[model samples]
Target chain A: MRLYLAYFKIKFLNEIQYKVAALAGIATQFAWGFMYIMLFTTFINNSDTNAISSSQIVTYIWLQQAFYMLFAFWSVDKDIFDSISSGNLAYELTKPVNLYDIWFIKTLALKVGKTVLRALPIFLICMLPFLGEFTMTAPVSIMAAVWFVITMFFSTILILSYIMIIYILTITAISPLGVKITFSLMGDFFSGGLIPIPLMPDIVQTILKYTPFYYIQNIPYNIYNGYISGNLEIIKIVGIQVFWIVILIALGKLLMKNSMKKVVIQGG
Target chain B: MIELKNITKTYRVRKRSAGMKNAFKTFFKKDYEVIKALDDISFEINEGEMVGYIGPNGAGKSTTIKIMAGILTPDSGQANISGLIPWKQRTKYVKDIGVVFGNRSGLWWDVPVDDSFELLKNIYKIPDDVYKQQKTKLVKLLDIGEIIKIPTRQLSLGQRMRCEIASAFLHKPKIVFLDEPTIGLDAVSKIAVREFIKKINKEDKTTIILTTHDTQDIEALTNRIILIGKGKILLDGKLSDLKKKFSKKYLTVEFNGDIDQLCDGLIFIEKYKGRIIIELNENILTLAKAIAFLTSKIEILDLEVDNTSVDDIVVKLYQEYGI
Candidate 1:
């Protein structure tokens, strides 16, 4: 546990060293948020359905943008690929810790640290006078806030499991770049980062609800918006998230175990 | 103690021709060739012994080191170190071993060396007191106190290599595998690294296996050497014995009078002014007999006898083995 924490600390410090990249990311996410809010507001104005209000879409866009570092499918852990190609993986393998757990902690630290660094700035930017309407509202109730936190926690684990699958695929597949780009694009389009799931067509929403990508961003945003208010409904949502987390974790572990047996450190 | 029996490792490397057509064809259906990186190689090293592992390019030196360090699993073999099989008990066995690859940087490039050390301290689970003691000792021994606070990317190759070696010893590992430790180092830096390695081996009783292309490093560091070629152990013995086996003695004499012809066993190499150089085979011609014959033939003004250097002997060995 201590060793894992040490990895986390090192990775956190490493990520924060690129302050320019963090600032630039905040700027880009704010621009995207503004465009999204305009598009969603125009769409809401033409619709009569009350399934999701214009204000709710605005808040969802704002929240997703503020937490883009967490929601996006960026390569949160480039070190894994770097180590493999640079032949440092051999040295890392000899360390007295599980390779999977160490990388997991590092990736977690990278996401959490970068998210913390950018989320507040983006949120503050969204709260400015011109963009005040896009600012996220506080949780409707304490119970909603509690469920929001729980869902966000599970969302983190689910995303980690997803990333683990990519890491393993990099070892087994001939080229993981195509796979990574495809997954990233799919994750954004289907995970409610581009458009809120509730506003999508019923068929699309239904299909997404059954996929793990929906839980990554959509569920947490909905819980924060108080869309899932009843105790039974909240429990059901949390249970689904947990189920996906377990399944993804199990698949990730099995893939990692099989792929590691054929690991070839590319260069000396 | 370390023991290896019939350790073998093979790599499957993709093959393709140069033309675009061939490249396109390979893209669809690749060809693979099997490369035997290690083939039935076996050796033993007792505790507190330092051995030099020398070979030319692609001679399985790094492969052997990786297998012994628990980073690689052999295709078939038994490798037991400190009563634990390296590949079988990887995590536990690696606790007592350290590995240094010259072409790789084990330290984080963006952080201070001290931060990397602290991280390793936790990774190895060293006691706080022990960690401090070992850190101080290694830092002082390597004379890297001033540079430890600087980021690794800011240091020169020599400074970074020093930190690398020091970091590997921070946990007080019982065994260390140094693959090309002095590679690309200046003469002074090389001497400093060699001295540090010797100091640790003598003071801490740490066993070391060093692989290098530089024969000077072998001469300055280890008494025993294992030479490998074509994924097999071609020679393993004391360094002195290898030199004795391949070295030829040479006698150079300056005399007032010398004949144009030489004896049957003596081959004249050069004659300049009044000096004559002759190659002598110890097996065919005794040193005493050669000296007597030369002295009887001419009035000797000056004489010198010399044996081949370790470097020459190694080159000869490599050629004889056709590696």
Candidate 2:
């Protein structure tokens, strides 16, 4: 655990060095937030189907933008991927640490560090009164806020385990491009990054619920906005999150073990 | 202690021909060619022995090092290092070993060298006092006290390399594998590295296995040489023995009179206005006999005798092995 913390600390410090990139990312996330809210406002206004309120949708979009770094599947650290492709992973293997845990913590640190840089400002701006009806609201209650925090933590780990599978696949893959693109696109669309689960077709939502993807951003953001309420419902949602986390982690570790067996470092 | 027997590794490299057509074809139907990287390689090294593992390109030198370091699993082999199989007991085995790949960095690039060392301390679970003492000793020995405080990216290659060696030693590993440690280093840096390696090997009794193309590194640091070529161990013996076996005496004579003829044992290499160079087959004629014969033929003013160089001996060995 201490070894992984050390790896995380170094990667966090390394990530926070890119101040200019962080600034650019913050700006891009805000632009994307406004664009998504504006596009969805028309649907909410015209549609009779009130799956979720307009205010909840506004909060959802804002939360998505604020924690974009944490939930986005495509935002993998390029350096880590390059290390695998370039055979610099050989250096990593020489260390007396589990390779999977090192990469997992490093990537977790990267996402958390990046989220720290961009989330606060987006939160403050989205909550401002100037945004009027589009402004992000606070949690429904203190209990809901607690559940949000708990579920978000589990959700992040669940998504990370899914991403770890992608990383393990990259070890045996001849090219990381196809694997990265295919997985990220599928992950992003299914995990409610492209469109919120409530707005999607019922059949799509039902199918997503069976997989781990539905529990990712869909559960936590909804709980925070009061879309998912009551102690019993929250407990059930959190239970499902924990279940998926265990399953995804087990699947990732199994894939990682198999891939590591045949892993060939590319260069001398 | 370390031992390897019949270690074999084969790589299936994707084969492709030139032109866009072949590239397209390979994308649809890939062809792989199996290369026998390590062919029945076997060797043993006792503690505190500095052995040089040398080979030409694609001769499986790095593969052997990786296997020993626990980063690679050979197809068929038995490697026992300190009563543990490297690949089977990876984490435990790696704790007792350190490896440095010259072309790639093991340090965190954006952080100070000291930070990387601290991370390593945690990774290896070294006690605070031991960590501090080791860090101080390594920083002093590598002369990177100031450099370690700066980010690794800002340091020069030589300075970074020194830090690299230090990072690898922070845990005081029992065995160190250095693959081309002095590569691209200037003379002074090379000597500093060589001296540091020698100092560590002597002081810690750490077994060092170095693979380098630079013969000077092997000559300066290690006495035992294990030469591998074409996936096979071509030579393994003391450096002095290989030197004596391949050594030839070259006699350069400065004379006033021109030599009309030469004996069977003396083969003329070059003829200048006042100097003549001849190679003496030591088996056939001794150096004293060559001088006697040369003096009798021409009035020798000055004569110099030189033996074959290490570089020539390596080239000769490579040629002999047909690698």
Candidate 3:
């Protein structure tokens, strides 16, 4: 809708104003990327099971860092959270608009806006060949690159849908802190932000596949690193990503509708 | 046209005492107290009418506004605004109404005020020509043409409030609910806001319901006022009628001779050499009779007559109602 586009533009423009925050975020991502690489190398070097190759690990870590914000499960729009908690939602309700749709677009714009500022620098820096073993490699094939792009787009929406569910959950709770913390911790570990899925034990990866988190960062980054390949297999994974996106969004909308009926703005 | 019948709202709030021990104990048991925010209350407003909604703090003024604005639903009520139920058909009903809360902002804090207006235009689906006309009129009336170019956070409170008023009217809704629109404003800004409100309500035939503790706002803007206290509608009548009911006249006279006793309706407040301040109850003693008595008693050199202000009337009303 045109209204949602306008909201997106306003939210995106608002987000890009924090230039210092973007710079600080880039530095933190680099530090985290290097630390993750260092820890992963020791585990891969000591093992001989060949669960994941060294080159795949390096590329996966770099890609995750480049698009860190896009896939981050803990990154919720604080404005939306505050609106729910502080009774400012009364103003939002006065508008002739659906609360869920506006918030979805706002979260999407915030993630895309922040990722735009930080992703490019990390991508350009990590592509440099002089970094030796730490350098990030390109996609294994042109088809893999295409699949990576497609999956990344779905994954972003997928995660945003999941975040909306958390938002609805927060609305039902007395405080947002508990929901945010519980989801942040659970999503971080399950979405493979804590560790690459291929590097984890086989049974854990099998268990994660049953949940939507397995399809989030795990599928896209692995596809880029050539860990999950072949046309049929990649197509199957993309299909599953679409499936989860539909499911999470439906679940979120249902919850939002139910919660809205009982929603009470406590004080003016 | 707006109407409410038997509207009631009750809020369940968790009860807890102070200190860690009581807090811990209540956390487990979780006792809740139901507060009747709005009792069985009803009122109606005709088109193009400006009504002042006055009450003490926590008197359900905001709750009634929220219910009518579609931000809240009452526990039991039937409210029809423009032939639409506010809570049942919120998305459709809200299209005809606007709301402004004085202490809170509806604008995007980091963006230019124009951007927020643009978004509102899109959200309300206002036609291009209509939006432009509304914007130009509001900007000129509120004197926010230059202020709209700046980001909202950069503007002063007065400037931001002007823009806020402008944004709410950009769509030209049929009704506008203003909760303390003149609060914390300087004299000039307050007058400008009041003038703009009056102009809009008159020109567009837009119904306006204003709630404020500022008696001057009520006195200057609205003729009809609905007074609520303790979740009940205590008084609903014309402002002039309430003024007549609680009216008192203060007469200060500087005279040559004033050594005299007061009448039954006349109470002497202050007496100095050749000067006297008397409280005249207009209900019992007319202003003309009080003046006649005073002139007869002394050769009045100078006289000053003052009426009881709206503030005093409100305090008296509250005390009378024991709220």
Candidate 4:
């Protein structure tokens, strides 16, 4: 755990060296956050369906956009996979440590830095305009925000396991682009990044329920928007994430062992 | 300790004719061919033996090293290194071996060599005292004290290869695998690397398995040679044995007094006004008889016999095997 924290610190420092890029990320996050807020407001203004009430819709959209990186699993998880597949994995392997823990720490650090530099600032920027229409007195709502962050962290690991499976074979076939493309479209819609699941028709929801994407985004959206208000639902979501974390970590370890069996790096 | 039995490895690669149509055709139904990289290879090295693994290009030298290093599992064979099966107990097995691949770096590109070494130390959890003592020794021996602090990107190829060898030895593993330790090095750098490797192997008894195209590397460092050709162990013997078999013969002669007539089989190869030298095939005429025949006819010059060098032996081996 201490090593992981140190690795996180090192990764953050390395990332901060590119100050302009970091600032640009924060700026981009804010622009996209504000755009989503405006789009949700227009949807409520122009439609009678009232699929989502204006204030609730705006709040959920802000949080969703703020935490876009947390929803990133399939597309973002390949960073580690790519490193491991290219004989570059030796750099990590020669270390007298576990591959999972080291990568796990660095990955969380990247996402956390993104969350801090981009998401936190974007949330702050909306405060000036959102203060007038929203109620800030709900401290229980703050608990939901905390749970959503935890969900995103665990969700990232679950998604990484799937990506690692593709990477293991990437070492064999000599490419990961195909697997990356597979994750992009299906992962985006399934994870509720394209559209909120409950807003989807009944049949789509039934189909998506079987996929892990719902746990990544839709459930978090429910918590953020008061659709899931009870403490019990928060516990269930956290429990699901913990469950996946255990299973996925184990699966990743197994694949790592099997993958090493075939990686011939001597002359290559 | 390392042992390999009947190891075979094949790689399936996609192949296609050059054209957009072929590319499109490959996408739908790829033409794949299995290349037999290693075919029924076997060998064994006792502990503390610094053996050189040599072969012509694409003779499966790297494949053998990779399998022994636990990077690949053979298609059909049993391999045991230090009483551990490599592919099965990978994590534990790898902890005891240090590997350096020439032409590729294991160091982080943007970081200083020390930073990379520090990370490796932490990763291996080496005792600070042990790490410090060994590092100091290697630094002094390789004369890389000033180089280690520089970023890897800034170091020259020779400087970096020294650091690379040191990095691999930090853990003081039972065996060190060097794919091509002296590749692309200047003559001085080559000698320094060879001396450093020789000192370590002599002092610490560190078993080393090295593969290199540099014959001088084999000559200067290791005496035992395992020659592989066409994916099989063709020759396994000492440097002297190999020399006696295929090495060239050289005999130098200096005139005791001025001479004119040269005997047959002894061609006048070099002449420096009043000094005479001759070249002859040792197989066709023995040196003593040639000298005796010359001395009987005329006053003879000083003469010395020298066996062919390992470099010439390697060239002849390559030609004879036709690899």
Candidate 5:
């Protein structure tokens, strides 16, 4: 655990070197959080809407932006694959450490540290104006906060599993230009990175629930919106999230083992 | 200790024809040609032997190094090092070996060289006392004490190469594989690297397997040479033996004053102010008859002869092997 935190802190210091970029990153998160506020506001004003109350919308947007740190995924593959193909892999391989874990966890720490450091502060800044609006029971608010944290944690695992699968596949495929372009496009529409799914097209909204993306954002978004309700609904969402996490991880392991066979053949 | 028996590796490489149309076609069709990288090669290095692994381009030098380093598995062979199969016991086996690829910089680009060393220490799980002591020794030997505190990105290639060698050795592994370690280095840097390598090999008896196109490196380091060509070990013996086996019938000729005549196998290879020197094959003509002819024809300045250096033999080997 000490080593893990050391790696995290080292990465944090590395990323903090770009102070202006870090500042801009936080500013961007809040600027975009306000856009979602306008969006949900436009939706709530459509009628005396109980589907999503105005305060719940604000809560949902706040969680979506605040705990956004939970869903970030990073992989060691991009660096590892490039180095392997370019003959630089020899250096890392000659070392005494597990090369895979070294890169994998370091990148994970980088993405998580950057996101939390950027996302939480901006989320709090954006939510500061609406603190006067909420008058909820402390226990209920605490439960909601705990559930949102759990949602973020499990969702991150699912997303990381997906990234791991892509990384393993990249060994055989070479040059993950296709994956990079796809992820860049995915960021534009899905994962609440750019826009919330509920306000998207009917087909997109339906697809989001099936994907791990919504758990990363929209599920937590729903929790704060109070759209999630009843003991049974909570059980189902949590159960499904856990199920996907297990399934994704198993699938990632299977691919990783299969890729190990190819690593023997291709020597990547 | 390292043992490799009949190790072989083959790589399937895509073959593309001329024209953008064919290149586009290969994107889908993917034509491939198999290349035999290592062909039934066998060798054993005892614990302390410093051997030079020499070859021409595409001669499987790097492949062999990678296999020994645990980064590659041979297609078919048995290789066991210190009771561990390299590719099978990768993590464990790699801990016992250090590799330096001359072309690549392993140091973090933006971080100080010492930071990279510290990271390496953590990576290898070296005890703090040993790490500090080794770092001090390496810094003193390589003369990179100042540069180690500076970011690697700002260092010159020679300085960075020094750091690279030091980094690989800090762990004090039993075996070190240096692939073209002296490549592109200046004369001073080359001598410094050679001296350091000699020191480590002598002081610690670390098994050093070096691959280089530079014959000077071979002469200065390994007395035993393993020559590979076309993915096969064609010759393995002492460097002097190789030279003796390749050359026969030395030539001696003394030219009177400066008379320029172009003749096959008669080389104007060496010259002095009062004399002209040439090596003529006694197999082609007797040295006594030639000397008699030369002395009778004109005034003889002076002439003596000696065997060619190791460089000429290597060039001849390449020509004969036609790699």
Candidate 6:
């Protein structure tokens, strides 16, 4: 556990060095947020009656933009891929720590660090006096706020587990780019990043509810908007999130163990 | 404390020819060639022995090192290091060993060297007192006190290599495997690294297994040399013994007058106006007999006898094995 914390600290410090990249990411996400708001507003205006109000939809889009880094599946970590390709894997494998946990902690630190760096600035910019109207509303109740945090915690675990599977694939000599693109597109499409789950057709929403992607961003977003109310519903949603986290983690561990058996550290 | 018996490792490398057509064909149907990386290699090193593992390119030097370091498992072999199988007891076995690859940077590129050391301290679970004591000793020995505060990327190759060696020692591992540690280092840096390696081997009684192409490193550091070629252990014995076995005696004499004549065992290598160089084979003729024969033929003014160096003996071994 202490070793993992060391990995976290080093990776967090490493990610903080890329402040310029984080600033650029915030600008790009803000632009996308505006585009999403306009699209959502037009959809709500054309519909005779909507499940979610226009103000709530606008706030959802803003929140999605702020949490983009946390929910999104980025590329396979190039540092790890390069380490394997450049033969640094030899040194990495010889460490006393478990290889899976080493990468898991590093990946978690990178994601959380970048999210904090970019999301805080985006959140502040949205909360400015002039932009207050576009900002998300506070959670409907204290329960909603508490469930939001709980669901987001589980959501992060699910996403990290998903990324770990891709990393394991990379070590097994399969290119992660193809899997990354497919998974990213599917995750964005179903996780309410491109379109909110409530606005989607009922059939599509039903299908997404069965997929783990729905629990990642959509659940947290819905909780923040007070769409998922009552203690019973929040507990059920948190239960499903925990289930997916465990399943994904088990799959990652199995793949890692099998792949490492035939591990080949190429080059000198 | 380390033993390997009949270790063998084979790598299946994909074979592809150049040209777009061949590339496309290989994408569909690939051909693989099995390369014997380590072929029945066996050796034993007692604790605190500094053994130089030397070989030519593709001679399985890195493969053997990897197997010993627990980075790769041999296909068929029994390897026991510190009474634990490296690959089977990887987590526990690795804690007692440190490895340094010359071409790779084990330290974090963007952080200060000391930060990486701290991380390693945590990774190895070293107590604060032990960590500080080891770090201080390594810093002074490697002369890297100032550079430890700088990021690894900003340091020169020599400085980085020094820091890398120091990082490997921070955990105070019982066994250290160095693969080409002095590669690409300047003469001074090379000597410094050699001296430091000697110091640790002497002071800590740490077993050091070094693989290098530089014969000077072998000459300066290790008394025993294990030469591998073509995935097989070609030679393993005292460095002095190997040198003496392959060493040829060279006799250079400045003669006042010389007659054009040659002996059965002596091969005339070069001849000038008054100077002549001849190689003596000890099996055919003794040095005393050669001198008697040579003096009778010509009036010798000055004579010098020299034996082959370790470098020459290694080159001769490589050529003889056709590796």
**Each model's TM-score?**
0.94, 0.97, 0.97, 0.86, 0.85, 0.94
Which residue pairs clash in candidate 5?
A: B251-B280
- Candidate 6's DockQ is 0.77
Relative to the true structure, how large is the alpha-carbon lDDT of every model?
0.86, 0.90, 0.91, 0.73, 0.73, 0.88
Report the C-alpha lDDT of model 4 over A1-268, residue by residue, as the tens digit: 5556656765665555556775786677667656765675676678775555667666666666667765655435344655655666755554446666676666666666665666666667665654665421121378877766566566667665554455555655556777666765677778767666656777988887666666666676666677666788778777876776677677777876666666655344
State the displacement of the C-alpha of residue B243, model 4, in Å, after optimal TM-score superposition. 1.9
**Relative to the unseen true structure, what is the Cα RMSD of model 1?**
2.3
Using DockQ, rank the candidates from best to worst. 6, 3, 2, 1, 5, 4
What pairs collide in candidate 4?
A: A96-B123, A96-B124, B254-B301, B256-B301
Among residues 3 or more apart in sequence or in different chains, the pairs in candidate 1 whose N, CA or C atoms overlap within 3 Å are none
Q: Write the per-residue lDDT of candidate 6 for residues A100-219, one digit (tens) a residue.
A: 889889888888888888888777777676765567677778888888888888988888888888778777664656766777787777777778888898898899888888888888
lDDT of 3 by residue, B66-162 (tens): 9999988799989989999898889999998999998788999889999999999999999999999999999999999899999998999999999
Fnat for each model: 0.65, 0.73, 0.71, 0.33, 0.55, 0.76
Error of 3 at B249 (Å): 1.1
Q: How high a TM-score does candidate 4 get?
A: 0.86
Chain A vs. true chain A, TM-score per candidate?
Answer: 0.94, 0.97, 0.98, 0.81, 0.76, 0.94
- Off by more than 4 A, model 5: A1-6, A47-49, A62-78, A130-140, A183-190, A198-210, A221-242, A264-268, B246-275, B280-307
**Model 4 stretches with alpha carbons more than 4 Å out:** A1-12, A49-51, A74-86, A90-103, A129-142, A225-227, A250-259, A262-267, B20-31, B251-307
Computed on C-alphas against the true complex, the DockQ of each candidate is 0.68, 0.76, 0.76, 0.39, 0.43, 0.77
Higher-scoring candidate on DockQ, 2 or 3: 3
DockQ head-to-head 1 vs 5, winner: 1
